[model samples]
Target chain A: MTGTEPTADETPTTRSIPAVAVVDAQTPGNVGTIARAMKNFGFEELLLVDPPELDPDGEAYGFAGHAREDVLPNAQEISFDELVSSYHTIGCTAVTNEGDHNHVRFPFSTPRDLAQRLPTVDADTAIVFGREGVGLTNDELARIDEICSIPASADYPVLNLGQAATITLYELREMTLSPAGTQLPDLERVRASQPLLERLYDQWDELLVEINHPEEKREKTARMIRRVFGRADPTTREVNTFLGVLRRATERPDQEE
Target chain B: MTGTEPTADETPTTRSIPAVAVVDAQTPGNVGTIARAMKNFGFEELLLVDPPELDPDGEAYGFAGHAREDVLPNAQEISFDELVSSYHTIGCTAVTNEGDHNHVRFPFSTPRDLAQRLPTVDADTAIVFGREGVGLTNDELARIDEICSIPASADYPVLNLGQAATITLYELREMTLSPAGTQLPDLERVRASQPLLERLYDQWDELLVEINHPEEKREKTARMIRRVFGRADPTTREVNTFLGVLRRATERPDQEE
Candidate 1:
């Protein structure tokens, strides 16, 4: 199983804590800052879905400082669908009072709590955050396994988006502390590389073009691929899964034999 | 003993992660990002060396959305000197390759490996990152134990400062995963809420106005308060610390008797 998937723990320690996934997070500054954020709490493995190689220099580094490279280097930019299919994502956003569950510790509790619960989960979890201002859509939130809320002062309850992500991570780490001596899976190797993901995606695109799907159908096909893999958050273990899917879809079932 | 110290497991679950101390990280956005960085990885204590209160809302939080608050809310802003005394602080920067022992980790290295061999270390090892632009001056780096490097591709060896911080944290987290069940300390009763922080800062200015401290010193004094408590990263245990400090500093020792 890849780092994204939550395998039943051989021992509590053996369980992989869910990771922090930044989906469609477009800001370079935020990217650097988030890297620094991940590092601060020992949460490595930054997955950047659907972003360009960022400008190495900007005002954003003021916070990332020494961490710029760490965050930058580990960051993997992929398609939105890749993010959706690749991860068992737990997306966080500010909820209004109408939400019934004000206090479920899963997402809002603490980093430590989240970590503890990870082993219990059946699939992988990647925490997705939306771009600033336009928080995750209902569609996006619906895709998540569970929704979490941080209890904030009722008045200005919404946390700055990145801050919310950071808080969830913070709480997750706090919750993760326990059952030591559990062998952590090696530092997860992210998707092969941008070039690799780009090539693979391109290969699929070529096939899609050939299928001669209707103009309106093209977008739907792309979106479908995006959704299935977005939740997958692929790791070395899943190379075969994609290879198989790509082989079948591209070659056509008739050609597989 | 305080924040960023690598205290031997009082909590059975917390693996020893390297501590990162900000030696005068002046940018408000940087501060917030750093705090968020820590939270993302499940770290609580962020030690700031002498920073301003209500550090102007730089892009740090706006980008962070909810996370920007961590720089203010969860940060333990302290003096560089106090942090050094409190933990194993490596006071250096990778400003230029010649100046720093920059062992760039472009490929990757665990932050814990660096943590184990940290310079002039205490159990609580702190890697002190400096203020903007001019990193820790040679004078500051000298006090450090040993310089650690985030191995980078030889080409772009120097990471943007904040990115450097992000990378460092990422590496460290790779090494140390706290044993599960390590709980975070609860928030101090009198957290410097946005309003609280804003009001206190302004009131302190007025008080300084009353005392007629130098106009220049007014900002400096306000900054000092922010630095000290912010570094403290106060929890429920810290309410009295704020009140007590305020009582003594504002009212005058002479008046207390």
Candidate 2:
């Protein structure tokens, strides 16, 4: 989305990604920051739901920087009912602790999990961010289909409105962009299967016994090895190579040096 | 990191995670919001690098809410060179374009990428954020080891300081908290090797041909299938099962039901 100031020749286009809607936000800084975040994450639609009057030329634009025309100018003012009807509503809440299990906002999806689920959602969706001091009213949250929250330190879970929007949008953008290009290979590489790992472990155990590993420390040593290799999740090929090395190392003295 | 205000009896502990530092941030609101972001991401250390005098009783504490003690009271003031020597400095910059490639901040790592690398970095690390208007100066950036930027729309590259911190710290926290306790098993599950994927593709192509998929759309259809399955990255078991199903589906009427 270009942040160019709108001219008579230009027309707005609707975006396919989830639209961002802030409900009753109090500050221009937050509004501007939200706009900037939407642009940063390649999202264009913004709905100002019952927000205080925002001046495009003032703090809103000042904070929005280049997103002033693309995101801020195009932001629509919509009613709560309109928001509910136009898209599958996702309410955002900070109340995600076990204490809130009975609360309406319980079982909240973290932003990353929500992002992965968003693209598969068949309809237009809106992620509703609540106000600064107090978040969404209980009544407002009741109508939401999904509750998404950023996991944070429970001691002070409150996040600035702008920060919350940025984090959520960042995750969604990360998920969306991931499939298109070089997904993190390190994170996605195939790992050795359980049977292969166990076999490798058995080979290593025999080697340890033949080497006369300190009797008292052998179990601790084996457990450490299991823990370390288990965490690594080596690939099948790697496991095979390691097993080959172990076989040679453990072979009797009759084997050639 | 708990958000509780620190008391005289409670001692602060040094954290292994990167410390957040702000240089010449103009607004108290920005400082408060940054503190809130830090707390939200479980980061404890905050450094105010030559900031204007801030009133803890005013906007900073008011906006920080529960993070007042854990973040605000513990914030330290230090000089530029002091920052450089104290930690492996990561300079924050908005200028990540190719034009700036020759510039000091070129070749910046995205926040997510940086987060992945942070855990292995052996030293105290500080992610230094710049002023609200201009980010870190080129001279200041020169002394830093890594430049980390959030990927965003080129139209409005500027992000509110607080939002930037929130997004960067959120990514780091996500990566840090990940791989502990129930990580996404579906996402982390080892995938089938390339040879298996190719075999499955060959089987699917034959099935598509058998189903009388139109000639003109066959390549496109096959490509779409490849993309879909490629993205899913089915496991060895899943691929074997699907291939078995495809073999049955493509068999002549002589095959058993």
Candidate 3:
């Protein structure tokens, strides 16, 4: 399933894909935490919008761990307007917050939903995480195109800055890397058609009755056979083989020995 | 959708729920970051299995944010054996790692898969995350019932300690809080049956032809109409309304006024 960890040779240049921007972020530790998450999910660019004097030497790097050199030093400090013009900005907000009534934050997509939508777009995208205190203000939210939020417990729907960033990036990375519509391997057999599957099930149902399976259980046993086959998603050839076995079992009802 | 941020009266006591255990966790900030994530996801208990001296006054609390009061103080330090005895331990690992041949890590479930399985188990559970560097050794992994790993880019599948914890806890909490099989609201309209939808599409297809919607574009236009309506998943009543509107429009032929 992991198709071998994409070597340096396989991993394409990741810059200009989707940048992560933190607007008026309060804590340096959170920024450091965000940087670590960015690296985990294969995102490189970090944008700090209108700002704070970050402890580049201290908290930011300290918390960043291995990602310090890759994400922290190169993080760009830009005004909110600068970020808006360069990329399609997606504002992040909590759905249960007071801002839910606010038009700008009303239609919030879950991170997974946003991730699914992002791969179809070829444009450079920026997922902006709001401040630590109250999140993005009305003015800041207005500048973005769409809003994305992680679905959390309604009681404490709001996630910490780092946690939100990590979850969002994780979903984005997983989705972007392996799209939901990804095709299966060519070697894997195609599933049998509906009519053939129905025939197979019919044979199994008859066999169950011939075996004197409990009258009450005949229907359920037949249904379970359908479910197991459905989950297997067997090829036409496999289905035919199974049907043959059932046909033999039905024909030789006295061959229980 | 977020039902008024469940009131304190509605909030369930979360003391003995599924806990998070950090085994020999090296960084103080990662622990703090993890605590904040735990609180974000409504998970309360924390077990530190032979962890380092955490910065109680400094980094741990500072990074914990709002979760400091709830999760940090009550965190208990216990031996690995005690953790194994107390709960159904789930080891977290990376898929791209070299432990595929190992029994515990080979058939690792994704957090989503693990979450679905957890609700069926009546026993207390503990999801154990390994150290920041090399994840749980083979010896430690063998002690757990099952392994859970986040699907990440093969190029860099290893995530930072806190980010890994945050993502895992996020999925677990989201699933535990809102199981996928939960019924939708009663107000939600039931979708139209397949035959009804097919008939509606056939009518629309004929209407498209009558309107002379660019002879070459007729098929595409009809298909697009089907796609649009298909996505809306209209109720039987709504489908009838749309069919009636289409029927009238087709019959009028020349209703320019």
Candidate 4:
């Protein structure tokens, strides 16, 4: 997932992650954006069917971002026939048939469901995306082993090619890439300790007692404070700051009668 | 969700769907793509802080697609202060702090989590995206109420602005839009009936008997067939076709010894 370079060393049969295949895309910029999205989610192999001329200085490269170096340049130009025969294909389509009578589009899996199912299949898989406007032809869809659709508003379910690919890749990231090894902070380090929380609560209770005339409502107020802290999941630093503020308030002299 | 036109009649405070705010975006095309993505996911109001000049004939309009008429043209240009003051802001960032020491970027919610949490909050909400390059500055991030990060490959976590926005909008579509009311076929209509499935299984059993298959293996074979059908979830037509094929094979004339 870390490396952007194509895994030429590993044969297609051995590859675990699905190859991203774009079929007859109209815009080179869209292709580039798809490649960029592929890289973002850690997909390496890109298969292009009937691709446009990708001039190095053209929109394809210009929009590819870092993918220009790897995914875009190393894209495999393949035929539609070759795509279906070479790998177990899942065609990504926005428009779907209404009834099961058309088996090609019916019984489609959402990208989320595919992420769970595809990993168990012991075959090289390719996720095929179609043209921006019309999407995959019925002939092409029939040939593909399965169909995957992104759930969008029925009003305008047709996501642009780049977006459809990006969302699909994002959903499949769990299967394609390992958990991010980046330097992002761990959640556990931020959670305050139980003792610290208890001390904070004790301080709050004392403050309520010192400032309040209504003894019956003090317990309810204390419970509410606890619930707020529980929901916030405040960091250790935050807890300490809160503790400090409460301590100062609790120790303060009562106002003159 | 169906309408592309802005809801001019409803006040922002009264609107349920979160407004999308872009802060200091560099490219007009990205803004256009973001607007298109907004329309795709059924989000309406768009707020821009220090946005690029979106000319009528420029890339912004060109990329806006159908959104050019509504989301793009009607985008409200406001200062960053106005953005934070008016709505409960959620900042979207790719890079995050590693430790609790820097509270600004730590403890961020993923888009999936936000979809669940944001709907419960009564306040008018805004999902604020930063520049294409640097993203939201530390100063800007500190002012935001909460942070949301998309999970990506550690190697290349930085998604382009359009893809990032598109994915975020897609995740939040559950809250923004209702379930698709389009003519897409329902799953129940296609599912083979239990009786039909049983008949198909009976034909398969008859075929195995006619072929003089080992009696011990027949039960296992039938069970395997059942499992296959269960997984395939074939259409009524598919089940009937399978039944016809099995019946023909079972009733075929036996070859002379």
**Candidate 1 off by > 4 Å:** A1-14, A59-71, A96-113, A174-257, B1-25, B31-257
**1 versus 4: better lDDT goes to:** 4
Identify the leading candidate in terms of lDDT.
4
Per-residue lDDT of candidate 1, residues B1-257 (tens digit): 45555467655344445666777665666666565555444444567677645434564453333445553456676766677667766544443333112322111223445644432233677766778777777667656654454433232234344555654554354334343312221331234455555555565666677677899777778898778757533333233344556555666778755
TM-score preference between candidates 1 and 3, better one:
3
Per-model DockQ against the true two-chain complex: 0.02, 0.12, 0.13, 0.40
Clash pairs, model 2 backbone = A155-B3
Real contacts retained, model 4 = 0.52
Ranking by DockQ: 4, 3, 2, 1
TM-score, per-candidate, Cα-based:
0.37, 0.62, 0.63, 0.87
Higher-scoring candidate on TM-score, 3 or 4:
4
**What's the CA error at residue B251 for candidate 4, in Å?**
4.5
Better of 1 and 2 by TM-score: 2
Rank list by lDDT: 4, 2, 3, 1
Task: Write down the lDDT of every candidate, Cα atoms only.
Answer: 0.54, 0.76, 0.76, 0.86
Tens digits of per-residue lDDT for model 3 on B24-116? 988787788888888777788899988777766877887787788888888999999999888889898874233322344554567887777
Candidate 2 deviant stretches above 4 angstroms: A1-15, A97-103, A174-257, B1-15, B97-103, B174-257
Which segments of candidate 3 are over 4 A away from where they belong? A1-16, A51-56, A95-101, A175-257, B1-16, B53-56, B95-100, B175-257
Retained native contacts per candidate, as fractions?
A: 0.00, 0.27, 0.24, 0.52
Instruction: Supply the TM-score for candidate 1.
Output: 0.37
Per-prediction backbone clash count: 106, 1, 0, 2
